[model samples]
Target: MVTASSLGLTERQAVILTVGFYMITALIMVSCNKWALNTIELPWLLLWCQMMIAVILLKVTHSTGMLKMPEIRIDVSKALAPLIAINVLGLGVNTLCLVYVDTSFYQIARGLVLPFTVIFAYALLGQPSSSLVLASCFTVFCGFYTGISTEVNVSQRGVFFGIFSSITTSLHAIVIKKSLPAVNNSSLDLVYYNNVLSMLVTTPIVFLSGETSKVMATLETEGFQAFHSFLAAAFVTGIFGFLVNLAGFMQISKTSPTTHMISGAVRGVLQTLLGYFAFGDIITTGRLSGIVLILSGGAIYTYAKDKEMQTTTKPTYIPMTQQDVDGNEDNERKA
Candidate 1:
């Protein structure tokens, strides 16, 4: 029989396991959100509830010493404000797109994220890229266009929100990369601060958007049983949402952002297949071609970037002193 110690996994195995967990939880959260949106028609409320639950859980963890709480200074909060704002808007619009579009189409629509990310990285951060990378992004965009054009049950509103979601999502990622180190927080700490800030920012918007009134009306007209069911779904989805964030952060911490991007591409394919089998979504030739194009382009971009990084990364050179050389010689002679 294999003992626990004998069965211990290596660092690479651990990273793989974490990436798998992140992808699964992320896919589940998206599916669950889509389901809840279809059933309840309250996307903003669901999002707010998720943020609230995340904040509560994070607090509990911190109080119990299960997690460390980051130092929350006004300066750090201000620094993260823009990122938090973009994150909230991205998620809100993403949820709205799910409400409007079929799950299958939604996956295809999200293929624009990589291209948009590249564009924003260049514009905002002055990051330069190779022609190959740009061409790959163009291929990805063509895939998105092909998928959207061929979507039989396409919603113009869904398409609109999806494009905005991609833009905001890319911006959020770029800002996180820029701001995360300055804040000097761990992944969990960032999660905590992000949800806390999101809750604060979205609360008034929920009321102003008239979603609060709708929720109240839903509770009154739908009866206690229906209301309870909605709450239960929201709560479960909230838990999944937190897991997604936690796992994503853990994966990125253990691996490179490039690895995370590749995992996301894989997850997109899995999600597309799941949408078809689970929701009876129609799969056309164009859809298949689009998926292939996007995944291939993304993989190429990731590979090219990884190669570039390898070439650009310089090994640290530590000069040896005469004393150090003498010590090494002495040790060698003794050996």
Candidate 2:
């Protein structure tokens, strides 16, 4: 069992605390992004700003020497090129979806990620999945259709961006897996390197999107006060953006992977409710039913995957590095 050694908390206490914080950070990141983009009207610029803040936080955290952060080098750039491209695309599309969609409809919009992920895994990695997984994907598909069909004032552009984001998200997961070798298989390093590369890509886009003109217009119309308000919102969103990743990492380290995934399902439910109360988002019967179906499918998929892992007699990947070997030992010990 994982313990909060510094806090001297028992395993259950630690798990609850860690998972709760992880869920909260995830929720805040979404809500903050929605709030920031609501008035900003500049998705590319906001993305650039958030990535910049995340990069700064990562550098500071890496420099503190408290955590074992991988030393980023230039050599890995080529290896991470594909992932970087997908990361930028994914972030851009997700931001666009946030800009165009309501907070309550967000999950249903991205509900296709599971199906896309399963499809990509099979296509790219030649991995075989069980029938339960396919059934769950079908359920997710139904949920997405149910939600969109019932929206009284749905944004077609938002739905398009959302679907594109789902594809990128699923593609990104596979790309990240394949690119892990470039970062010494350290997820922390991947986050650091991804932000750095994504920033390089988004900086020019910020200007290309005419965000500078928008900024100037706002300043001229509302003065520095309005500009400062936007900045404050972006700053808060950026902090949560980075913290959400750290929270997820901490949750995984402090509990089993199963627990982490399960918490995500719960977090989605809470996010739906949070959107309804916090943002005056309408929760129609169809929307609510769609969300329930999606969540149910996701939870079942997670369970099926976990059971598949437990019953499988063979390991998937060959251990290439000492790190991989040690990780294998640790996983076995935990089990």
Candidate 3:
């Protein structure tokens, strides 16, 4: 869609096109088959698919550049190995968790990843928490409570799966954040490598878990509907998923963890709306209440962070040499 058309673009217009890409992909996927679509695994799978495609497209676009390619100092193997391990473990658990939890409930519960990231930061990075951060954390807890209250069937396993997903996601985030310094990786490269590694790891599981057989069954029984979902899923990962990661990585780190946490609340709202409008899924009273708390907290978090950023000085990226594209490394500073 718009994203595909805007490939290689890095402008405000490109960003808008990217949003259009996601909306179209979402609409198409949800409209094709809600039951099958909802049952599909985490969008991470699609993320990897997009990485593989992007790599191919990049190669095609830069065939001449490939011949004269700069010898990037990165150890692709080393960087990818740990990322793949964490991502596969996280995504595997997430995929299984999806089977046991409804999408809306899962969305609400996943907001807890924000708190988990703070905990992970404290534990892994020795990051100290201030009173303001502590207060924000408390707010997040309250928000989570309000959000999950409306979810149906409060089973123990459901709770376990949600918690597990949060922990893995938090760990994955920390791992990526820590790796950020040494590699000074682009979000595209980070995603591409992780996806490549995860796909390598997950391909075997796809066979072992009988996912392959299930996919075949889906094709045999559901025909074009199944095909459409498959294509939609692939497109989502290839295009929209990449943009989402890029935007979040670029934006979220600039804000406080609490602000990021509050914004995390919006996934449930967006997903619930998509479910209802696109698939005729019921918008329950509880979900409506949860959306309100989520939005309120997010608004508070954004307002606070905007005020905070206004008081700080951070350099905005100015395109320089090829080495300075990201402006995140010694090379960029040297240049």
Candidate 4:
């Protein structure tokens, strides 16, 4: 499935790919929690240990000259500061908010991110948003409401935290999109920057007051079986986490910010389906209706908005020379 931009994704394909990515993530998370619950003591420090392992792998790859070098231009005085700052807060707040939210309501609340992003882009960055764009945002929220109202009496705290997450997530998208033109960094570099910044900011608080030590002790004292299960879970998570971040970020860099945001809606729907299959959560009619609304809204909005933009403004990608047959190669290089 492919889009008009000549990118290799049809609307349905996008949803399926996004769903597959997050469904696997949900399975990993659920399996990890179950393993923790059943074990004598949970391997709480497994994630940190996994991070250490990742650092080792990164060092080895770099030393062995296996890691691909990305194009890097120094721009500390320009977009780097703000982009890094926005993502740092955005990622941290989103992660912390999950502690206060339930997954069902969180999915619904994330729909709000579209509208917030649209508003921020318009008001702060002076980007024009079409009526279709606005409608898409509303439709996503409606879908979220449908999904949540069906099975659970959504909690107020979850709703609040979900809203918080949406806003931060939107801000993250807007900041990254706005800054991409000037950053001149590859996807790998962006991933490294975002992850390193997030780790630095999240670390002190997570580890202070002996939290890190306690978590590590829990993992060590746990039986070998428990520890191994945790190690496996952490390994899967770390690898997939990096892949998702890389793919999603690169996709966003090539596409419109709004389209990127809408594409991510598939994550919530997919996660819901995964919950049903893996966690014994039942999907109700209302939830299915919500999923339809989200998919429909995203598709309609992206097509309409792109059409409108093309008629009035330049296409997102322009063929500059005979060498560029398909426009996507240039877009990818630019991104």
Candidate 5:
């Protein structure tokens, strides 16, 4: 029933292609990040590499005139500082969580982001949702709790970092929305600024955290082969990371955030399945049920939000009888 024009695609074939690109890139980004973390054991350094690559790719794209880069004035940079800080912190903690947690559990842990986003939206932005939306969010929370409850060999530290990551991620989203108007509502501009600022902020932390020493030691003991392997993994992860960001921007711009969220829910399922097949993660009945609940609740929340937007934006029409038209004509003549 949906056409390319209806979804703002370029051509008839592009609708599926765009959605697939977005979803696939997102899934690959998570899988590759987890793989890199498990293999290299340098989460911060790996993240730093990814950010550096993103910046380089952005610069190249700008140079080629594929994308326009926004100038960062002092005023705009100052306004965006909080968002940049929170974004960096959220990502740093998320990587740490991945390092400490199993990939399957990591997916479940990150599921907290949506509920936290809703809470922050209401608390900070004063954006209220209908009862159905609220109830759906509650269902999502229950699903996450169910997953956590049934998790075997759970890492407490990982869970702790995951919780903070969710909090920071939620705040990052809210701040992004608040700061977009300052950045001319360009998500790509925000991405550029965020990556640049994140690099500046993360460089010192990467060294201070002693990941640099660990990497150096590994290079010494394992030789250039190990270092080369790490570099290759980091490079691939970086490319995937850039694609993920680009695809995310495209997805959100072409569709609503609700649609983006629904895609994310689907991505989570795929990532969980990949974790099981690739990493031998244990999958239980309870965890499976939790995944179902989370996906269902997300879908419901998205539908509710979409319906609400439609209702709010729909135009109202008034019907007039011939007598009313005649009366208005007589009044116009008198005037």
Candidate 6:
């Protein structure tokens, strides 16, 4: 069987893979969501579809034995309620941001997520951060202000939605740590529950939003091409959406919240650059500076965290086998 031990991989390798999975999936999911939302003009319904599609895909994967679904339990569902609530709200604002903001501006719009996460963590979880981490958050806040001040095409509503998302996101990250225990610390189970509950909540949201009516009206007035495009984009994003969910939990399980924030900062940089090329987004000096400062803060934060971990970490002892002892004794006599 394939395993990390057989491949001689350290924890760092696993960290890289987990971070990579999130970065790549997030980048794709955001772009696809932007397309799907634009083409459909029904954010709630589109999100509902994505959630349902993700659940279906999960079920299919479970059937194939690639992953097993935990049986539905009332206790687990109740424990997951808080997470599901935040997940729905967070995603709702995120889709709204995509609807109203430029692809490149997306990162700047949501840039406060890290700082907010730090603040929420300390306030709610009673986890204190180092001085350097606090300084990094200050730097990131500066970058956020810089970009917002200089951007001429900034969307006021998009910024509002982004701020709301930051709040939900901070809460979501903290809540996940608490909720994971209820799922036996299994990322897959959490993913399953999150999507399933989201579907239940979003079903009514779609109708209450009047999005279903809008979709049907548009379909009757427009050709099939746009509808087909929406479907395709939704499917692609739905798959990555599930993968990103799994990746998020897997990463949170293995890394500190600080490290996860750093990875997200890295992702923001890459996402900004890609959005520039993919969407032909206008890049200004101020915007570029914001990206730089954000990335620099993430670097500083990561270094401080590494240094802290090294000092606080205890070393492990590996016992040698009898064969190794006999060989060492013979070598000592020869010497």
Q: For each candidate in turn, give its C-alpha RMSD to the true structure in angstroms.
A: 8.0, 3.9, 6.8, 6.1, 9.3, 7.5
- In the range 34-117, model 2's lDDT, one tens digit per residue, is 888876678888888888898888778768965555566778988899988998898899889988888888888877777887
Candidate 2 stretches with Cα past 4 Å from truth are 1-21, 62-64, 67-72, 247-265, 317-335
Residue-level lDDT tens digits of model 6 in 1-335: 33334577654575577778888888788888887877767788778878888899999999998988988899889989999999999999999988998787878888888789878877986768899989988888888888888988789999899789778877876787778778876777888999998899899988998887777787788857658888888888888888787788776655545556667777777778888898888989998887777777777766766666556534221112122122222111210
User: TM-scores of all models?
Assistant: 0.86, 0.84, 0.66, 0.70, 0.83, 0.88
Candidate 3 residue-wise lDDT, 1-335, digit = tens? 12322466544444344344444444333232234346464344443465566455544545765422223344765755666687777655654555555555556555566567667878876765545555555566676676667666655566677778778877765566555544444544554455455656766665777666766777788766756665665765555444454444433222223323444454456666766665565656775665565455445545554554455455422322222343243212110
Instruction: Identify the candidate with maximal TM-score.
Output: 6
- Per-residue lDDT over 32-130 for candidate 5, one digit per residue giving the tens place of the 0 to 100 score: 888787677888888899999999999999999888888767888888899888878888898899888877777677777678767876787577878
lDDT digits (tens) for residues 131-169 of candidate 1:
888988988998889988887777889889988987886
What digit string (tens of lDDT, one per residue) describes model 4 on residues 1-335?
12333565653454345445544554355344333333322222333433444444555666798775343345533456677666655544443344444333345556677678777877877777778877887887788677667756555665666677788777876666655545353544566555554455445655653656655676688645545655565676566555556565655544445545765676666556655666565556775687677677777666766567557534443222222224343232321
Tell me which residue pairs clash in candidate 2: none
lDDT for model 1, on a 0 to 1 scale? 0.75
For all candidates in order, the CA lDDT equals 0.75, 0.76, 0.53, 0.55, 0.74, 0.76
lDDT of 1 at 317: 17
Runs in model 6 lying further than 4 Å from the true structure: 1-3, 6-8, 310-335
In model 5, state the lDDT of residue 86.
86
TM-score between candidate 4 and the true structure: 0.70
What TM-score does structure 6 among the candidates reach? 0.88
| Of candidates 6 and 1, the better by lDDT | 6
